[model samples]
Target: MRVWILSDLHVDASPWEPPPGERVDLAIVAGDVADGLTRRAIPWLAQHVRPRARHVVYVPGNHDFWGTRLPDELARGRDAAIAADITLLNAGQSRIVEGVRIVGATLWTDYSIGRPKWSQAWGMREAGDRLTGMRDHRRIQTRDRLGSPAPFRPFAALALHVEHRDRIERILSEPHGGPTVVVTHHAPHPRSLPAGEATGPGDAAYASDLSAIMEGEHGPDFWIHGHVHASRDYRVVRTRIIANPRGHDTSHQRRDGSWADERENPSFTPSLVLEI
Candidate 1:
């Protein structure tokens, strides 16, 4: 099967379209289609990208849930996806397409990928406070026991990460008849970080060291992910991991008096097709 992969479109910030004449048997939008869950991104994909592929699988990135409430937002996203005939994966859902077993989830990290010393000394709440600058903490909202609105802090995010990780592990361990593919919004291994980038506590917010799962006996044959803006294609143990993100648009002039041209992600090949 020929698969077309892309992510981090952030269409709300800038417009995007698939390369002309690019079509595939399956298309994977790893995540971060837009900032609003039920807004521009999903609708744009349905209208513009869905018809180009025979099958489409979408994973919701952190930005997709921005300006929305948790759990409820996920439900609404799922509903919208179903209405558009697109497959949306969340909470460790698996689907078998054309003899390929594909399992997907957001795979939120537990803030331990970089193993920062401060994180070990401080609690998750303190760590979360330190990361208040991240939009995930400030923009995404959830309800407390009394139904009061609260920021989706690191503690809750960690709990969710554990849940998704455990579920993914269980699914990956199960026997499958054909090639297995794992799709996630967050990168699964630290190696997915951009080349030459140093690891730090903040890095944990984007990726987790899930190499154990990839090295396991029943590890997947391929893993597709998007979160890190840099494009990557490499092998860990027996699995080949891939990420293709357009990142934020930088077409505007920068303070440095230089023009940034991220409008067309030079590293991204919209027509690049992977055969599995």
Candidate 2:
């Protein structure tokens, strides 16, 4: 099948549309079409994207959960997707399409991809603090049983990550008769980062080295992901890992109302397509 792959559209900042008359057998949106408040991402997909593909799969990125409690935002997205006849994957869900087993999850990082030697406890404390300072923690909220909304903190994010990772591992272990594709919002391996980029502890917030999973006997044939603005295509063991993110625009305005250099991702291809 001809599959179109892309992510990190960030439509709230910059809009996108497929080339005129472009179509594919399947379209996989890795995630982060927009923040929760605008609620434009999925709807935009429905109105402008779905008709171009025979099937479309959407995975919610961290930004999709911002501006509301997690469950509420997810519910809204799910409902919209269903109405549009789209498949929305979250919380480690899987679906079979034309003999292709597609597994998807947000796969939040465990904050150790860049610092593998650090103890889990130390990583959680220090790395967790760093991640908590990000906009995800500031904008996305989680609710208590009593319906009180609070920041979706690092601990909670890590717990959800563990759950999703475990599910992926379990699903991949089972036998399947068809090619498997794994989709995640966060980079599944550290190599997903741009080559030549400096590494630091903060890198843990963006990616996790899940090479163990990809190298397993029953691991997926292809893994597509987003979150890191840099686009990449490489192989780990037998799995082909690919990312095509539009990211933010190349330049931004300075105090003088002139554009300054801001190279977010120059390699993004709007027409990226892979045959599987």
Candidate 3:
């Protein structure tokens, strides 16, 4: 299978569509499909990006579900996936293609990243009101709108990661003789975060726990993730860890001044493609 990987393509940058004449067997989008849960925009973007692949598999990023109820958000995602002919993975969902097994979930976190710190703090509360993308992203309930004016549970940010270990454990437990690919929106290996807070899922603690739990085996043949907005390829246990993210705007950026410019770079472009 000619699998291509990319993630953190925020749809609010502008409505994006797959150009004609592109081709691929599978396209893996780790997360952040939208700037916020635009609801309608998910289907629009999914349908546009779906045809480029024989199969499309995706998970929503933190940015995709900032202030929404998890269940309602997931239901909307399923609808959009159906419209786009894409597979939106939840816990225990598995798809086998050409003998390669693919399974994933929206694994929730428990602040188990290195040193365990809260994603939100006192400053963060007021910060959103000042900054456009940085803090507003946390409070955004949907595209063109903000989430509740009242504060949310601080743990909510890390809560989604809670169930991930179990789902991933199950996926790793499967005895597929052929190649197995694990996809996650959070960084699977800490090293994938080239530079950042160096504390959460993008750091060493989570990866260490992940590697230890799936004992007796080093790891899967292939693993891909996106969260910290870095392009990395290395080994953790026996797995080939790949983190290739076409991220949204932030303080740091690789190329291009805006998401529009980033979108113009085709999926097959060297910056976006991760063939396997």
Candidate 4:
């Protein structure tokens, strides 16, 4: 099966637009399927993207649940989608499809622990307070609105990180006779991050386990990830890794200003597609 993989679409519901190619049998979205997974928008995704593919699988990233609870249908419809042959994975599980075993997990990074003490000491408390709107009601905004001094918690954050990695391990233990594909919002490989702050899911902790899984005699043939928005390729263990960012924003274009103009717009690209 020829499968196409992409992630971090971060779609907003207005007019459902199809990708610039023929529809295929499956679309695997790692995360950020829509701006929000609320009661309203989640259904819109089901209507717009799900029906177009024979099998649609997804995992919720930090963005999907950013400051919100899981939508009511996110679970039920997820199961329904699986029943409809559409698989929706959250901070869990593995799904087998057409000889390819797809495993995935949402975004759970160390940053969400709480703001770093150092950042708080280094003028971050006041900034976080102001940004969080404690001083002004209207000032509170989504975490995505800012890009510095991210929340941090060394211990609990570490625990959450271990949990997700353990999930990946547990799934890999099962038997699926074919090429395996692992989908994760936070890239498990070291080369995936930008210089920002060594944040995001601490891949360091899971490096050994990840290496063992991917390097196993029957490991995955390919691995796809989303979080770090860099379009690059690498090899981890015996698996080929592909990291595709959602897109580059031209509004802030001078820092590097090198992305292709045609590919600069914000749009949804189905995470994974398979052709029979």
The C-alpha stretches of model 2 lying farther than 4 A from their native spots are 116-132, 145-147, 195-198, 250-263
Mark the regions of model 1 whose C-alpha exceeds 4 Å error after superposition.
116-127, 130-132, 145-148, 195-198, 252-265
Query: Clashes in model 2: which pairs?
Result: none
TM-score of 1: 0.91
Global lDDT scores for all candidate models: 0.83, 0.83, 0.58, 0.54
Candidate 4, residue 239: lDDT = 83
**lDDT (10s digit) by residue, model 1, range 217-273:** 988999999989888899999999998888877687889999877554578766667
- Worst ten-residue run, lDDT, model 2? 119-128
lDDT of 4 by residue, 42-150 (tens): 5655776666666667766545554443334355546665555556676657877777788877634433222342231222232224344122112212222243323
- 1 or 3, greater by TM-score: 1
TM-score of each: 0.91, 0.90, 0.72, 0.65
Candidate with best TM-score: 1
Q: Candidate 1 clashing pairs?
A: none
Give lDDT tens digits, candidate 2, residues 202-257. Answer: 66678888989988787799999999998899898999999999898757799999
Question: Candidate 4 local accuracy as lDDT?
Answer: 0.54
Report how far residue 103 has shifted in candidate 1, in Å.
Answer: 0.6
Task: Give the Å error, residue 82, model 2.
Answer: 0.4
Lowest lDDT block of 10, candidate 4: 133-142
